[model samples]
Target chain A: MIPLSHFMIISAALFCIGLFAVLTKRNAIQILIGIEFMINAAILNFVAAGRFDRVAGGGQMFALFAIVLAAAGVAVALAIILNVYKHFRTINPDKIDTLKN
Target chain B: MSAEQLAFYFFASLTLISALLVVCMQNLVRSIFLFFVTIFSLAAMFVFALADFIAVTEVVVYVGGVLVLMLFAFMLSNKELLSGLQNIAGGFKFTHLAGLLICGGMLFLLVSAISAADVVNLSWIKNGQAISENDNTIHQIGIHTMTRYLLPFEVVSVFLMMALIGAAHLSRRERRS
Candidate 1:
């Protein structure tokens, strides 16, 4: 059997990549891509840990909910990003700092 | 290595590589398309982990649903604006390096913690009844969703409904009264 920690390491690396993308990517859509990575990493962790809860399948159950919530969130976020694009005529997050000035 | 180990490594590598490509590729359309690979490989990983039901859902919801939605958003956002704009995010820079450094440190911390903790020998794994590898998780998931998971199931449906309505309202072109 592959060690559970191996799974943990993979997910951690995935989360880090997502974080790196979020920090470096100027475009909001790309940032959303990063957020997807981070969310997947988290879902993977839940499934890994829930391996022990054979009786309830709580981890899998929660992971399912998490996935649904993620889909909803991405949908809403993209809609909002659409609105931002409409108003600013650009999707680069850095340049849309009306509140900063 | 055994076949299971080999399969695990294959799926895991596929997941990681596609994910990296999704973030690193300069072409937005290509990266988004690569995300299909990432999600499919992740679903494979889920199957390898004995969460077959989750695996199927991952493919259906992510590939069949979310990616298509993202692609629509990508097109609707307008090709001319995207193509005409300079892609500043594709370049390397000090800030990007700093972000990489910080995230790499986090991964390092997580790896060390997982190793030091020796998660395989945790009390729950030691004592908990392991789900037989062959037991049909789909059946159990169904029972739980209808019985124990009933409330959350209903709420998620409602949440989906809200998203449908809200997104339609939010994205529609506004008109002056």
Candidate 2:
């Protein structure tokens, strides 16, 4: 049987994986996926923390808000990526150097 | 281990594996698919953690709704820019090593801190203990939204509206003269 500490540890590992993905990936969409991973890790932590917090359920509620916000953010980012693709014909992110003075 | 602890391990493993795939997979579509799996597993974990409301939101908002739209956008922009092996470094071995070391250190520190702390069960952390068990879960959330979190909620709505307008403008091809 797993322990709460194990959940916390696994969440930490997931968070690290997401962080590594965000830091190492060159593609914008991949980075976005990393961001999604990070958010999910946080949400997992929150929900787990909320298990013992039945009264307020603040952590659980926050996870809900986070899920919505992540969706919104991902949508906006994809639109921007589409624009990036249209302009450069490439989405390598590192290659989008026109705006970078 | 206790039943709660056992369930925690079960779901935690699911969350970690899917999350790893979400980052490591090279194909964008596959990556997005893994992202959905990760979120669903997380929702399951939330349920196991006794966060029914959060679990529902994680599934509905994240898996059912958001991931679908994101994958649709990914398909729309599926030009396959890089050859998946262009000038990219061949797995920066040193960097990967360094990252692992640092992450390992961080993990050790976190576990130690948690263990060392004189912690007790935190059930008495808040007032109005019956709030979670009440039938008006959504209704109570709404009340809190207006009473305490109204400003942030309104801002998020505005942000969503702006994002919608911006996406529409950005995606529309201008009629060339």
List DockQ for all candidates: 0.77, 0.50
lDDT per residue as tens, model 1, A51-74: 778888898999999999999988
Docking class of 2: medium
What is candidate 2's lDDT per residue for B40-76, written digit by digit as tens?
7777777666666677777887777677777776666
- Candidate 2 wrongly placed segments (more than 4 Å): A1-7, A52-55, B2-4, B82-95, B98-102, B116-143
Q: Cα deviation of B83 in candidate 2 (Å)?
A: 4.2
What lDDT would candidate 1 get against the real structure? 0.86
Task: Give the lowest summed-lDDT range of ten residues in model 1 chain A.
Answer: A92-101
- Model 2 chain A: lowest-lDDT 10 consecutive positions: A1-10
- Using TM-score as the measure, which candidate wins? 1
- Writing each residue's lDDT as its tens digit, candidate 1 over B57-172 gives 98899888789888888887866656653445446789788998999899889899989999999999889977668798889999989988899999999999999899889999
Model 2 residue A66 distance off true place after TM-score fit, in angstroms? 1.7
Instruction: Give the DockQ (C-alpha) for candidate 2.
Output: 0.50
